[model samples]
Target: MTHYRSFVALGDSFTEGLNDPAADDRGGAPDRFRGWADRVAERLAALDPEFRYANLAVRGKLIDQIVAEQVPLAVGMRPDLVSFCAGGNDLLRPGSDPDRMAKKLAGAVRDLRATGAEVLLFTGVDPRDTPIMRRARGTFAIFYLHVRSIADLYGCRLVDQWSMQGLRDWRAWSDDRLHMNEEGHRMVAAKVCDVLGVPTEDDWRMSWPPRERVDPRVKRREDVQWVRSHLGPWVVRRLRGRSSGDDLDPKRPDLKPFG
Candidate 1:
């Protein structure tokens, strides 16, 4: 097997493995190897046993934040292969705009490609039919399309995460109804390996379903219960304040404010 000297992953929560309820140590340490990026890395290393990998993904990051924070690190790594998975948070808003997200995503692709790395772009699954995510279906679909276009334009390998994981099935996701569980991540990793032309082990079957597939009715009820139980007074207070005004201050001095 040919060896890739370095691998880098860039993106947001899905890339960072946020809210993976099935994770053994959820909400404390980040799910490093549990996410798809690390799973891909694990497969790569299994073949070569000396592959170096770095993950620059952070939870709750938007495309803009990824450009600001993660891009520089990835460029510096000069990785042999770089995998990118992002844009879910950008689609979370009610009026999420895919055109703007596409522009930012294109910029990220350009920046990564400038380093001459072999880029692998991982697209996201749409959880719109899920109780918590139904409203953002359009946004996710648009983002996924744009991401595919960007990958093609930049000459990167595109991993169709939506098709690979069966996004139409609510059971493929974690309890949060957002991120993928261990099985889902494994499926994503398998697809990525396929794109990269990496051989899979005997245990790495391509069509395995998730261990636990929550019934849609039960998932909806649990989603409601989670919102009621987890969304405490402080969260309500914060949300109310956000509702009263625009949370994204156009003149915020900290960020490199958009013109």
Candidate 2:
């Protein structure tokens, strides 16, 4: 298997690892966030002492913003491995065209590929059963197909999130119903390792233990609370043309050795 000496990840909140705060056991700073990319980097670092990684992802970035802000830096870093996951934020907007977004992403991928780095891409997870997101399942699928096509055309590695049945469970997601929780990030890391031919103890497809079903009344109350706490503010931001990441920067900007 090819041993990548360096890896750089580019995209928005998912790549930035929102909602999944860094744990003490992971040796990450308590104030910082640690997502699946960080988890993947840890495993990769174990394979080689000199392995370096950088994450140029921020929260609330649209596809265009990512292409403009993150892609160029990733190219300059010249890492042997690259992961790109964008366009989900755009898909959330009304009248967003998946085809156009795909074209933009394809151009970025083309440039990344020109650098001879092994590019990795991800499909948005299945959102059919997800609240609010379920409304845009059709759009998400279109974009996912485009991503698959790009991966095939460019010979990049793919993490097919749509096929990961394990993520379909509510336990895999955070209370916001947008980003994944700690368990969700862990599973994603395992999946990435599997794709990169890295040996890992965790299995992305591992089944969850049996649990009692939630009462329908309690579920209804939670839904109302979610709308008030999460969905309401998100809609307001869209109206005002703002983002959650407006003041945020990438947690790990430099391509340096990872522990």
TM-score of each: 0.76, 0.96
lDDT (C-alpha, whole model) for all candidates = 0.67, 0.93
Quote the RMSD, in angstroms, for model 2: 1.8
lDDT of 2 by residue, 8-100 (tens): 999999999977887566575666778999999999999999999999999999999999999999999999999999988998889999999
Q: Which one wins on lDDT?
A: 2
- Candidate 2 global lDDT: 0.93
lDDT of 2 at 87: 83
- Candidate 1 Cα errors over 4 Å, as ranges: 1-3, 19-33, 165-167, 202-220, 229-259
Q: What would the per-residue lDDT of candidate 1 be over residues 96-136, giving only the tens digit for each residue? A: 78899888888888988999988888666656566545677
